[model samples]
Target: MLRLGCDVRVTDTDNTDKTPDFLAGHGDQNCHIEATTIDPADNPSAEDRNLEDAVAKIKTLDSSDFQLRLIVEGRISRTLSKNELEDKFGKLLVGNDPDEVRRGIREMGDESAPYAEIRGRNWCLRGELQPISDAQKVEGGSRELLIGPMGSYSGDASREVREGVLKKAKKYDRLDAPLIVAVNVLDIRFDRETENSALFGKEQVRYSPNHPEIPAQLVRKPDGVFIQGGHKPRYTRLAGVIFFDGFVPHNPRGSVCLYVNPFGYNTALPQPLYELPHAKGVDGRLNRVEGVDVGFLLDAKSPFKNSGQP
Candidate 1:
């Protein structure tokens, strides 16, 4: 809240505690601040569960470090079992000498097997593999090894976030004060335009060759989530949403994006918190977005006012 210019103080509450997440400000000016996360597993389908399992298995490898950049095919095999694939991969790491490493692993598997190669003057190692056909996706492979961040939001993934926000928001429905739900859009292919449609109402997703940089905004198409007289967000009780995009959630070094709902339907919307100065033009905190935008904090107030301080 200090990031928003609020003279806020937070307190801890245990699992069985009925108290809200925070007691901001001091003395009589204090207000309740409840927080929750939008977990991907809360509402999962059979496929979602399966995919989650796959990701979990990949994560267990303990040696892979990748994100939006993924390795779906390199050093992979559609025909080898997981163990067999791992064995082949291990061969390529046999020694420090690149020439010896390649020669040593050459006889480890079939000549057609994908292998790892150490390239670049500084030895930028890479897994090399080819694509698999549709038949392979379901039947040809014994097991496949994919290393990367969850890419692209499937239809289910998109709907999940919408449902997730509302579901979490409902927890604070009848609360005395405004509520905020912070979500980590992990492994979610989220588009701002599509999300606005999910929240406000239906909006067409348009594509133009000339404007490829921007997704179709909330254009308010003729037949959308919002009709002639009303908006679509049924759970207007939610006052705002805070988000952390990309791989890790709540990484100590990451930043957050805030969105405030001004609609009256959220009758109890916590204006006090939302109104707290953002450190930016609005509720936006001027910090490094995607945790890597250049020129961040150039002319913006530091969003970490309370960092390293009590």
Candidate 2:
């Protein structure tokens, strides 16, 4: 973020009680900074955790013991608790037959959907797993396996962005300076226009792919808070909302990326903050909007640039 035009001076905080994450000054002007992400996936319940652990343990079992690998399907992730999960595993121990274990779970259709597989293990449970169950489960020749943060795209996740911004804004409503919220959209399938609607409260409309100019009337989205009375009384202290998308120019070797925030900036920017050298994000892929400037989208891409053996 230092690479951006918002230059700042580090100042020590004397407050010992409730406060913002940290304080910064752009020249003599200052504000509070809070960082967050745009994730809408519901937290897994204790039952969900048990299912995951059970699947992980099942994956470590000897693959040769069954007629086929212990392919339990991924549908049960959110429903199974430790005891229930143990019962499924115990079914496998009953006869040393893999087919029996597979049959014991379900008929292999409907409620129990195949989520992922590693070696001989599988998981099936009930919960709202995202990217939905229809996402490609087969990778290479391997069973469909989930490897990272799971989610599906649409308006709900974007609403999370709004909720996060408003909540953060409210948290620092009493602060004497402007409040800026930085959101990470790396794991999300973020649509720029959708997020804008969420922020400004516009009915994010869409047209049919078959007819370029044709519009869809019945499915119109309602006005969001920014368009209604939602933003007036609550977001008064919010000075800016910044987005951190992933880096650009993918590669096995590292490559730089750009960050763009379509919204205009805060009113309390410091003179020194404006005076800092502008960052040439992704070698000028991003143009300078009036209030938006270049920024560093690091941390997400930095972890892998090392030898694994250390």
Candidate 3:
């Protein structure tokens, strides 16, 4: 059995004919747990309804502290808008950055009360989008980078991108969330000769990722720059790099696609996808084999720093 935390107790409530999934205890308090099975038919609105049902059931428990966890076959994609998701369940779940919420609530004049009390004492639940892979099964060494065409990177844009990435990483560092960089590949331009070609004949594009000095020739119209030689034509360049905290499906050829989890906050480039190298066989032709990777950033000092209760 996969255990998220030692204090958390997992039991099958199916035999009891209850919709609740399991029960957990925090100190002397008993928290009612509900595991909702979500499918394509169960959209955000449906999920919200399920949450309401779970909350109603949880309130009937002898204890006031209870939570609801949702387990699904895949990530919950395209259910609620960002504002809506945060509005309804922001306080209940642990976000990428607890400081942001604390600051927000404090700014609203609630400094006298701590966030933990507001979270624990209330009859609220934290929605966990439990993907197929539990935290334990997640592997390491699955990280990759994606750089866009030369024109996509605007003047001093790379610095901005790097800074944004670092900022988000710092915020989620405590929660062990991955850092993501989204680059727009559609805004890149090519040389006159390679402009109309399917294959990228530019030399600089291949080495853009490791290039120390960003080139000025690859500048785009209003702003932005691009990498010269990427995997595809105009669309072949790297759009972004996603640092996943756990195992995620990888399509090197950039074919198979899945949506990101909408429950928790994401810092990676918003909605943009990256282009990957094509799968090759002995004859240098296309081959079909699914790839998966688990990318995570490590702290030099303590690897198990983010382990245990939040």
Candidate 1 segments exceeding 4 Å error = 9-14, 17-19, 26-31, 39-45, 50-156, 188-191, 194-198, 205-233, 246-255, 265-310
Question: What shift in Å separates residue 226 of candidate 3 from its native position after superposition?
Answer: 46
What C-alpha lDDT, on a 0 to 100 scale, does residue 200 get in candidate 3?
18
Clashes of each: 7, 11, 17
Global local distance difference test of model 3: 0.28
Instruction: Give the per-residue lDDT digits (tens) of candidate 3, residues 97-165.
Output: 435534554575434222221122212233431111223235533321111101121111232332333
Residue-level lDDT tens digits of model 2 in 154-216: 223455556666676666445677666666654344655545555656554566889978766
lDDT of 1 at 216: 57
Candidate 1 structure quality by residue, lDDT tens digits, 34-91: 5655555565565455444544543333221111123331212122234533454444
User: Which one is best on TM-score?
Assistant: 1
- RMSD each, Å: 12.5, 11.6, 26.9
